[model samples]
Target: MSLIKTEELVHDYIRRDEEGNEDGRIRAVDGVSLNVNRGEFIAILGSNGSGKSTLAKHLNAILFPTEGSVWVDGKNTMDPDEIWDIRETAGMVFQNPDNQIIAQVVEEDVGFGPENMGIPTKEIWERVEESLKAVGMWEYRKASPGRLSGGQKQRVSIAGVIAMHPKCIILDEPTAMLDPSGRREVIRAARALNDVEKVTIILITHYMDEVIYADRVFVMDKGRVALKGTPVEVFKHVEELKALHLDVPQVTLLAYELRKRGLDIPDGILHMEELIEVLEKICR
Candidate 1:
C-alpha cells in the first residue's frame, strides 16, 4: 500500500514587492503526482529552485498545496483535524542539525519528541535509549550536544525524530552542511532506519552518491518530475544530470567515460566496488 500519495500537487508562493505590495505568484511545485509505498526508500533529487524542498514540505503538511492534494498514511493534509496525526505519521528532518537539536543533553533532546507527545515516562526512556542506539549515539547519551561532532549531532537529530515513532521519515538535505565523514554517518543512520526499522524513507538530496542505496529516485526540474527510476536507471543519464546543474556519482561518471571510449561498461556504475567487479569480469 502507498504510505504517501500526491495527486496533481501544486504549490505557489506569492512574490511581494519591497513595499509589501502584492506582486505575483511563482509556482514552486507544479502538478506533481507520485506515490511512495510503505517501507520504501525513495530519493528526490534536484538543483536549487527546482522545487524539491517545496515538494518535501507537502509530505508532512508543512506546506499545503495550492491546487491539489497530499495524503500521508491515508490522512489528507488539507484536513485541519488530521494535521497532528499526519505530522506524527510522517516525521521530517531538515538540513541543519544545530537548529534541530534543542536540549543541551543528547538523551534529553532525543526524548523531547516523545515527551511532547505525552508518552509514558517509562516508554519515553525506552524510546530514547533505542533511538540513540539505532543511530550509534547511545554511548554518549549523557554528553552535551554542543560537544558532539557534526555527524554525531546529526544522528542525535535523527534519533530525536525516530523517538517519535513516525511511520515515515522525510529527510530534506539532512547532510548538506556536513563534512564527508559526517555525511556518511547521517546517510548510514538513514539507511538503518529503512533496513532495520522498516520505516518508510523519503530522502531529498543533491548528492548522487547519497541516493545510490535508495530503492527509487525522482529527479525534479522546474517544478515537475523530469525523471524517475532506480538509481542505476536514473544515473544512466549522466549528461542529463550535468545539464540540470547536478553531479552524478564519481564512479558512475567514470563508467560513463569508459563507455564513451568504446569500453563495454554498464551505464550506471554506483561505486568503486561495483566497477572493480565489472573490470574483473572483463579481464578474465
Candidate 2:
C-alpha cells in the first residue's frame, strides 16, 4: 500500500496588505497528485517558490490543503482526530538543524519526542539509544548539542525524529544549510535509515547529486509537477531540466554534453564510474 498519497491537492497562501486586509491568494501547491509507496526512497526537486516544501507540509498536516485531499499512512490529514496520528506516522526534518534541536544534551534532544508522546522512561532511553546509533551519533549522546559540528547536530535532529518511530519521513531540504561534508553526512544517515530500517523517505532537495540514489524523482515548477521519473529517466532530458532552471548531476551533465558532441556515450550517466566504463567500451 502507498505510505502517502495526495489527490489533486491545492494550497493557497492568503496575501495580506499593510492594513492586514486580504490582498490576494498565492497558490503554493497546485493540483498535485502523487503516491509514495512504503519503504520507497523518493526525491523531490524544485527551485525556490516551486511548492515542494509546501507539498511536504501537507503530508504531515502542518498546512491543510485548500482543495483536494492528503492521506498519510491511510489516514486523511484533514480529519481533526487524525492530525496527531498523521504527524506521528510521518515525521518531518527541516533544513536547519539548529531550529529543530531544543534540548541541551544530545540524548535529551533525541528523547524529547518520545517523552512528549508519554512513553515510559525506560523505553524512552531505549529509543534514544537506538535512534542515536541509527544515525551514528550514539558516541555523542552525552555531549552538548552546542559543542557538535553542523553534521552532528543534524544527525541528532534526525535521531529525534526517529525516536517517534514514524512510518515515513519528510526531509524538507535537510542538507541546504550544511557544508559539502555535512550534507554528505546527513544524506548518508538518511539513506541508512531507509535501507536498513525500511523507513519510507521523501527527500526534498535542490542538490541534483543528492537524488541520484532515490528510487524515483519528482521535479516541480510553478507549484506543479514538471517532471517525474527515475533519476536516469529524468536526468536524460537536459534541455527540459535546464529550461526549468534546474541542473542534473555533474556526471550526468558531462555525459549529456558528450552525447551532444556526437560521442557514443549513453544518456543519464549517473556517476563518474559509469561514464568511465562507457568511454572505455567506446575506446575498445
Candidate 3:
C-alpha cells in the first residue's frame, strides 16, 4: 500500500495589498497527484520556487491544500484531529542543522522528540541510543551539538527524527547548506536509513548527482510535475532538462555531449563506469 498519496493537490498564493485586498493569485502547487509506496526512495527535483517544497509541506500537513486531498499513512491530512498522528508518522528535516538541534548534547537532542510524546524516560534513552547508532553518530552522542561538524550535526538532527520511529522522512534540501564532503555524509546516511531501516524517504534535492540512488525521480517546474520516471528514464531527456533550467548528472552530460559529437555512446549514461564501458565498446 502507498504510504503517502496526493490527489489533484493545489496550493495558491494570494498577492494582496496592505489592506489584504487580493491583487492576484498564483497557484504554487497546481493540480498534482503522486503516490509514494512504503520503503521507497523518491527524489523531487526542481528549480528554486518551483513549488517542490510547497508540495512537500503537504506531506506532513505543514500546509493544507487549497484544493484536493492528501493522505499520509492512510490518514487524511485535512482532518485536524489526525494532525499529530500524521506528523508522528511523517518526520521532516529542514536545510539548516543549527535550527533543528535544540538540546546541548547530541543524545539529549535525539531523545527530545519521543520525550515530548510522553514516552517513558527509560524507553526514550533506549530509543536515543538505537537511533544514534543507526545514523552512525553513536560515538558523538555525548558531545555537544555545537562541537560537531556540519555533517555530524545534521546526522544528529536526523537521529532525533528517527527516535520518533516515523514511518517516513521528508528532507527538504537537507544538504543544501553543507560542503561537498558534508553533503556526501548526509546523503550516505539518508540512503542507509532508507535501505536498512525500511523508512520511506522523500529527498528534495537540486543536485542531479545526489539522486542517482533514488528508486524514482519527479521533476517539478512552475508548480507542476514536468517529468516522472526512474533516474535513467528521466535523465535521458538531456535537451528537455536543459530547457527546464535543470542539469543532468555530470557523466550523463558528458556522454550526451560525446554522443552528439558522433560517438556511438548511448544516452543516459549516469555513472563514470557506464561512460567508460561505452568508450571501450567503441574501441573494440
Candidate 4:
C-alpha cells in the first residue's frame, strides 16, 4: 500500500497586493496525483516557484488541497483528528537549519521533539544519542549549535527530526543553504536514514546530482509533475530538462555531449565511474 497518496490534488490561494487588495486566485499546485511507497527515497526536483515546495506542504498537512485529497499513512490529512498523527508520521526539514534549530545545545535540540511528545526523560536521552549517532554527530552532541559548521548544523537538524522517530521525513531543499561539503553531509545523513533505519525519505531539491541516489525522481514544472522516473530515466531527457531550465549532473551532460559527437556513448551517465567503465570498453 502507498504510504502517501494524493489524488488530483489542487492547492490554490488568493494573492494580495501591498495595499491588501485581492489579486484573484492563484493555483500553486494544479491537479497533482502522486504515490510514495514505504521506505522509498524519492526526489522532487524543480526550479524555484515550480510549486514543488507547495506540494510537499500537502504531504505533511501544512496546507490542505484546495480541490482534491491527500492521504498520509492511510489517514486523510483533511480529518481534524488525524492532523497531528499525520504530522508525527511524516517529519519535515526545511531549507534553513538556523530556523529549525531551537536549542543551544545539539543533543538538547535533538531531544526537543520527542520531549514535546511526552516521551520519558530516559527514552528521550536514548533517542537523542541514537539520532545524533545516525547523523554522525554524536561527537558534537554537547557542543553549542552556534559553534558548528553549516554542514554540522544541518546534520543536527536532521538528527532532531530523526529523534521524533517518524516513519517518513520530507526535506524541502535542505541543502540549498550549505556549501558543497555541507550538502554532501546532509545528503549522506538522509541516505543513511533510508538505508539503515528503513525510513521513507522525500527529498525535495533542485540539485541534479542529489537525485542520482534517489529510488525515484519527479521533475516539477509550473505546478505539475512534468517528468517522473528513475534518475537515469529522468536525466535521459536532457534537452527537455534544459528547456525547462533544469540541469543534469556534470557527467551526465558530458556523456550526452559525447553521444551527440558520435562517440558511441549512451545517455544518462550518472556517475564518473560509470562513464569511465563505458569509455574503457569502447577504447579497448
User: On residues 1-284, what C-alpha lDDT tens digit does candidate 2 reach at each position?
Assistant: 79899999999999999999999999999999999999999999988999999999999999999999999988999999999999999999998888999998999999999999999999999999999999999999999999998888899999999999999999999998899999999999999999999999999998999999999999999999999999999998889998898999999988888898999988788998999999999999
**How well does candidate 3 match the true structure in TM-score terms?**
0.97
- Which candidate number has the best lDDT? 2
Off by over 4 Å in 3: 15-23
- Could you tell me the TM-score of candidate 4? 0.97
| Candidate 4, position 96, lDDT | 88
Candidate 1 per-residue lDDT over residues 135-249, each given as its tens digit: 9999999999999988999899989999999999999999999999999999999999999999999999978899999999999999999999999999999889989888899
* Residue clash pairs of candidate 1: none
Model 2 segments more than 4 A misplaced: 16-21
Maximum-TM-score candidate: 2
Query: In model 4, which runs have C-alpha deviations exceeding 4 angstroms?
Result: 16-23
The reply for model 1, stretches above 4 Å from the true place, is: 16-21
RMSD in angstroms between candidate 1 and the native structure over all alpha carbons = 1.4
- Cα lDDT for residue 92, candidate 2: 94
On residues 170-240, what C-alpha lDDT tens digit does candidate 3 reach at each position?
A: 99999988999889999999999999999999999989999899999999999999999999999999889
- Each model's lDDT comes to 0.94, 0.94, 0.94, 0.93
